[model samples]
Target: MLVLPAVVAALSIIFAVLTVGINFNLIHSIFIRKSLNKSKSLTLFYLRFVIDGFLGLQNAIMSTFILLKFLEVEYDEPVEFLFWISWTSMNCFNVRGILVIVISLDRTLAVFMPISYHNFRRRIRNFYLAIIPLSWPIVNNIVLWGVCQFRVNIPPGCVIFTCQMNQCYISYALSFEVVSHAIIALTSLILAVKLFIWNHCTQKGPKSRDLERANYLALIDTLIIIIFDIVPAGFTVKFPALSAQFGSLILVCKMSGYALESWLVRRALKRTNDIVSVSYANNSSMIKSTGQASSNHRHHRHINNHAWQ
Candidate 1:
């Protein structure tokens, strides 16, 4: 009975640690590595990774608590501490979904209208745009906290946050997750088709190839989101009893997904850097060769003129 939950809790903590490490590295790469920061899309991805790192830490702590409970180990914490965790968790969850939607839309625009997308990106400040999505989480949690304060009571001796404490907030959050994921799924499919057609019909160049690679990475991200997030949310809603039994496993899966995403982004950035380096080397060689040829031509011309004189 407790065996499965204990195993899952252990795995969740392990994965959470891995996820946090990967996210931290990715954030550092984006900040310190100029090559990785070239793309505007990565700005949003940077924010996502930051949120993911925080969630990973939270998941680790939560999983430890769950594991202790399964082992019948007694521990105590202030109710306020648990409440803040729950509140922050809710905000992070909602904010992550919104970021996914925004990223998907950004990819779609870049694919369909490359010139316009470039112009738009240049004109608008991504940092300011980011504030819009970031604000949603705070506003949402505040409202939910207010409602819980007045209308709902935190059950005594609650070990962790559960949806039963506030079904209204849970329902709204789940709905948002479902709808946003649906949009992401549809957009990813469309981008896949468009990329396929463009690849076959149009001439492939460095820019086009880079775009394709980035979009494919985004598609992989969508798959991760659908598998870890949407599936678990659906299971929780449709099979609450079963979901409760394996909640720790679901958290582990989510942490695994986040880790995978961070690793993929890092890999893609490295590949892009290699391509840029190679292209730069080739261009430098060509320029050097051209300069040598021009210099030789001028030398020969000067000799010929002197001989004619």
Candidate 2:
């Protein structure tokens, strides 16, 4: 028991640090470096990375606390703090689920309705659309907290074991998680199949290939979320005892998934930047060569006129 918690805590911290670092770079690249286009999809991705960073931090702290408790370290687990963390983590989780759906929809639109997608993004430069996902969890958690107060069998500490105390909230959250993930998975699968057929049936240009790549990336991202985040949530709802035994490990897996996603996005951004830079360089060279050729042509015409005169 002690060994498991200790190892999990270490892994959690390592992945948490990695996640934060990679996500920071991803945010900087997207917002600062301007490696990707300013579209709704990238906006949602930015929000996702921000939430991922927070989740990673929360997991690290919670894992450390769990390890300390297991090691018999003399420390107090404040109920208020634990409850706050639990509540905030739940809210972040909900936001992430919404984000996954939005991301999938964004990709699907880009593939199926390219012109409309481009025009809509051009018109909506602000992040007003993001408020939907951001505000959903706030409303949900308020209702949950209000209902939990009426429950007679409240847990002593609002930590890992608190799910049993707030059965209603747990059930609602788990169901939402599972259902949302299922929808996202189905959407991604259909989108992937459609994109595959489209690509196979037609001769595609660079723009088409880029869209294809984006769709595939979205598909991979959804897969990671389903495997690590959704599966764990479903299993926790079905086997609550499993959560108590392997909560730290589950957190580790979640962090690992986020870390992997951050890395993939970072690499994609770098590749895009490289391609853009090379294209710009080539265009500049072509323009310079054209200018020189025009100048030589003009000089030759001037000499010919003087000789004829």
TM-score of each: 0.86, 0.86
Candidate 2: minimum summed lDDT over ten consecutive residues — where?
150-159
| lDDT of prediction 2 | 0.73
Stretches off by above 4 angstroms in model 1 are 33-37, 115-121, 147-157, 203-210, 296-309
- Best model per lDDT: 1
Model 2 segments more than 4 A misplaced: 33-41, 115-126, 150-158, 161-165, 203-214, 233-247
Q: List the residue pairs that clash in candidate 2.
A: none
TM-score of 1: 0.86
lDDT, model 2, position 192? 82
- Tell me the tens digit of each residue's lDDT in model 2 across 93-116: 788888788778878877778888
